[model samples]
Target: MTISSTPEGVSVQPRHIRFDVSDDLKSFWHGNNAFRTAFFNALSLQFPDGEQQFINAVRLYRDRIEDPKLQAEIRGFIGQEALHSREHKSYNEALKARGYDIDAIDERFARHMKWVANLPPSRQLAGTCGAEHYTAVLANAILRHPEWMEGATPAMACLWRWHAIEETEHKSVAFDVYRECVGDERLRRIVFLFVTWNFFKYTFLNTCSLLKTDGKLWSVKTWLGGLNFLWGKPGVIRKCLPDFLAYFRKGFHPWQHDNRRLLEKNLKELEAAPSAH
Candidate 1:
């Protein structure tokens, strides 16, 4: 795809970390809010399969890339996402052991990715770029707001934060691949619109499925609390609107937002923390 040069001061380094999720880890690991916790867990269910889709989408044009740095970043991006898929599978398995039906949710998501795999390569790459931007925006929010993961169990929090750090690190790889290979601005925007719709719709449906299985779907308190958490006070999703909309800018680049400092800080912390690789 031959991007002219990598984004200034931005590159991805893959980290392999082993997170030990406790046997007692509950489904409601985040602040004891079932809906909030379920929402994040639903997102987790998407990753094992979703990440493979991203990897395949980017690899379609890998040989076309001419820049050494971008090529290295692509490798790093693939490696990081591969590890994420593996660890999230373990995380989902832990949830399943807790009696949650996360494996069913993951299987359904895998079916969706299978459909995505059948699309044209350009369309597939565009979809990957769209989802990467979504992840980058959300990762930026998680890095910026400590309260988002407040009260989460230590192991669970470490896993989420680690994923966020690596997502931030490789946020632009797929977008740059699309820009360099497809160069279709209109198609990119249109695909993002579609991806936005499907992303939210599926996430909502998945969260509901999780909630239903956990016997919290009809809980008014759970709904109210979850709604408030996402759209009200702390407003993780609400506060991300600006960054999310920035994706549509004429020369939108993930590094333009420049949250690399957060990634750096996190890497340092994780390196110092006692953990197995």
Candidate 2:
């Protein structure tokens, strides 16, 4: 894949930091609320295997990428994602210790990724680009709107914010690689639709599973509050709809959203926030 151009002025550096996700951490660590806690926990459950798949997909085309800048960014992307996988694994272990059956979900996700690995490399990389878009938009939402995480415990908040910061940093790496290698706009959009369906389907299912394990699945109040939190006032997912749809535009690029200021702003806050260490 010949290099076109990298995102201007964006540095993709990995931050090596650890968080205290010990067994003593509360099960309902996000605002002491079961619904919010399960939602974030479900995301944490997906990261370890999902990120490894991402790294592998990108690696398939790494040698073909002749552009030095894109090559450098790919290195940083892999480094950051490796750390994300490590940290989220620790976080998910805490959930498992709390009796959430995380192993079942991990096994299921592993099986699904095995299937994905059999697909053509273009499809795999396209899927990675799609997933990266989801993370980028969600990261932008969380960083741009602090209220989404307002009531979370400091340790958990720091971990997520740090993840968000890196997500924002390298959001365009996979897409740029995909463009340079495949450049199939139609295929990219089609695979993005498929990725979108599976992303929400699994996240919702996993959240429900966690809630069931917590004995809160059948609680009407839990569903009501969770739905409202997602779609009502200060709706985190709801507000991200526009950014998510932007991926489908004819000349869309991840950096088109241009959240560098937001990234820098929150990165500084994350650095100063002692809980992040």
Candidate 3:
């Protein structure tokens, strides 16, 4: 992705996540697809409250931050999250229309964000940055997982793709802010590792929970499909893990990700299509 310097302090246009599914349940990996929806729906569910959490955390340690760039990045994060919430709200409604009570699942998410929001800025930033990394990994993972994603709703993949782009784009801003504000590598590292593990555990449970709500939990077919997508895809993990490890490879930051080209390239194609964008 080619990097363009934005007057607004280097930012990429937001990408939208759309859920794609098969026309027929018989033709698609319904459980996996539904589970993925819950995964992101969880994010959307948390968006408003999550931003509140960020706002509160930043306020809690407001005096610690002075960089205009960091401040701008925080605003960007809030804006992106707000947009995510709005979009996901619509998507969640779509799920509800399809007979799923997403808000029931959403309640737990709201509480979690509230808990995160109440933390100190340093810890808050560390936790958030860490979570974004997990998203980066998962997004890249989905792009790589062809079997699970194949016959996948163009809409669904696009949702994950758009989210992936943002995750890739903003992967390091939080860490940078945390490093600058708190200067606690050890704590940040621990938070990073712990948050990511939590991301997986919580996400898996939430995904499965929603699928069960939709009556599509844990079939061997879906489980196998999910595995096939993560492990079998070529150049997928290669593309993903590099970004993860790239953080520590020297002079890494948000701009270093520069996934703009990939996001734009994919978006150009995505926007033109009926299901993507």
What do the candidate models score in CA lDDT, each in turn? 0.83, 0.88, 0.56
Q: Which candidate model has the greater lDDT, 1 or 3?
A: 1
Please give the lDDT score at residue 268 for candidate 2.
89
Best by lDDT: 2
True-vs-predicted CA distance for residue 194, candidate 2, Å: 0.8
In candidate 1, which residue pairs clash?
Answer: 1-64, 1-65
lDDT of 3 by residue, 1-277 (tens): 2122232333733544444342322222334465444445555544455545544554454455576666666666655665655655666566656666666667877777767666666778777766666566655555444444554555665565666556555555556556566767667666667666655566666667766766667577765655554445433334566666654444345455444555556556556766653
lDDT for predicted candidate 1 compared with the true structure: 0.83
Top TM-score model? 2
Model 3, 35: alpha-carbon shift in Å?
5.9
In order of listing, the candidates' clash counts read 2, 0, 12
Candidate 3 residue 249 Cα shift, in angstroms, is 7.2
TM-score of each: 0.94, 0.97, 0.71
Give a tens-digit lDDT track for model 2, residues 97-160.
7777888888887888899899999999999999999998988888988888888888878888
Q: Which stretches of candidate 2 lie over 4 Å from their true place?
A: 1-8
Residue 131 in model 1: lDDT:
94
lDDT of 1 by residue, 1-277 (tens): 3563445665677776888775535557777778878888889878888898999999999998988888999999999999999998888888888887776777777788889999999999999999999998898788778788888877777788788888988888888888888989889988899889978987898899989988989999999988898899888788998888887889788877877678778777766756434
